[model samples]
Target chain A: EAEVAQSPRYKITEKSQAVAFWCDPISGHATLYWYRQILGQGPELLVQFQDESVVDDSQLPKDRFSAERLKGVDSTLKIQPAELGDSAMYLCATTQGSNNEQFFGPGTRLTVL
Target chain B: AQRVTQPEKLLSVFKGAPVELKCNYSYSGSPELFWYVQYSRQRLQLLLRHISRESIKGFTADLNKGETSFHLKKPFAQEEDSAMYYCALMPGSGGSNYKLTFGKGTLLTVNP
Candidate 1:
């Protein structure tokens, strides 16, 4: 069974440092999503990508966060000057088509000290 | 706007006992409901969807549109069935941009 791939399973960074997380969605998936799961909370949507274009980023903290999927396949999420509040498990998910079931990656746990 | 609610934060059941996880949603348009589960050290995966109308691993969920509920039920729970369950709602635009809203999640523990 093919699964979504994520890099840097765990990351530790000093406050105000920059960090990046990568995600490769399952093959043939067109829609990708980035979510942040804080301790004891459900995953919260940060951004949504329809192919290579961003569809929704209302919840994303644009001041310090950015994401891109240039080829409309894999994606990268970067956080500049990370803060203590940025520590969370970042999860990436993808769907085959619209309204389809989402497959999630193992996630990258970030710890901003 | 769409929202999902899982009332219980944790539920405990013994082996061979029946289990039910409560889920409710609020959406104006037609909604697609789903249940996602995450076992320890494993990625979150879909347990079932309302549209499929299929039972999986002795679990089933019926979409009650009138009541806006999609509770998951499983008979004869096993120890291995312990995990965190989340209820999700897909209320995004069509074609693409299918953003999903998830609930806080309910942790199920089945003891022997």
Candidate 2:
């Protein structure tokens, strides 16, 4: 089975630094999602993408965070001036359609000092 | 806005014992319910969805529209069943804009 691929399984950075996470969805998957999972809490949706277009980003902190999937096959999420609270697991998921089940990646664990 | 709530943060049960994880939701419109499980050192995966109504790994969940609950249940639990489980909900009507809203997961420990 083809799974979502994420780079830099673990990252350590200091506050006020910039960080980026990359994700490649399963081939042909049209919808991609980025989520943040804090310790002791479930994953929360940060952004959703339909093909190369953003469908929802209400929860994303636009001032500090930005995500793009230019080709609609891969995506990058960047956080400028990372904060202490940003230390969490960044997860990428993809689905073939709007109502299909999502497949999640191994996730990138971010640690900000 | 839709919200999912899993009341118990932790649940423990001996092997072969019955197990149930409570999940409740507050949504004005119809919604789709799902249960996702994450094993130790594993990525989060879908265990079951209410729309499918299928039992997976001896676990089943029923959507109670009247009570607004979608609780996961299993008659007997095994040690390998220990994992973190999350209940999620998505808007039922929205075409492609629907996003999953998850609850604070329940950590289940099935002891021997």
Candidate 3:
């Protein structure tokens, strides 16, 4: 079965450092999303991409967070000058269409201290 | 703005017993409802969608437009059913947004 693939299942970084997480969506999926899940809270959308265009990034902390899907396929999420509050599980999900079901990756857990 | 609410933080029940997970949503437009599950150390996956009107793993959920609710139900729970459940909603449109709003999630534990 095809699945969303994520790299670096876990990462620990110091404050003020930079960290990056990679994700590859299921083949043929047109919509991709990145979410941050804080402990004991629901996952919050950070960025969303349709093909190669960004549809939304309102909730993303622009000062420190950046995400891109260069070819509209594989994507990367990066955090610069990471803070303690930046520690959380980053989830990547994709859907064939806007109204279809979404498939999620295993997620990359980041710890910043 | 659209949002989802899962009241219970945790729910515990014995195997063979019935189970229910409450989910409520606040969305003015016609919303698409879904239930997703995350098993221990596993990736989150789709459990059921309101439109499908089908049960999965002995679980079912009915969308109540009047009440703005879609509560998940299982006649008899199994040990394998223990997992975190999240309710999500998608706005109705070209749906090109493809953004989903998820609830905090309910941790269900079924003891054998």
Where does candidate 1 chain B have its weakest 10-residue lDDT segment? B91-100
Task: Rank candidates, lDDT, best first.
Answer: 2, 3, 1
lDDT (Cα, 0-100) at A50 in candidate 2: 97
Using alpha carbons, what is the TM-score of model 2?
Answer: 0.98
- Cα lDDT tens digits for candidate 1, A1-105: 999999999999999999999999999998999999999889999999989999899999999999999999999999998999999999999998744888899
Local accuracy by lDDT, each model: 0.93, 0.95, 0.94
For B14-109, candidate 2 gives per-residue lDDT tens digits of 999999999999999999999999999999999999989899999999999999999999999999999999999988886887588999999999
- By the TM-score metric, which is better: model 1 or model 2? 2
Predicted model with the maximum lDDT = 2
Model 2 residue A45 lDDT score? 96
Candidate 2 ranges beyond 4 A from true positions: none
Off by over 4 Å in 1: none
TM-score-based ranking: 2, 3, 1
Interface RMSD values for all candidates: 0.8, 1.0, 0.8
Model 2, residue pairs in steric clash:
none
Worst 10 residues of 3 chain B by lDDT: B90-99
Query: Against the true structure, candidate 2 has what lDDT?
Result: 0.95
Give the best candidate by DockQ: 1
Return the TM-score for each candidate structure.
0.96, 0.98, 0.98
Q: Per-residue lDDT tens digits of candidate 3, residues B1-112? A: 9999999999999999999999999999899999999999999999999989998999999999999999999999999999999999988664688778999999999999
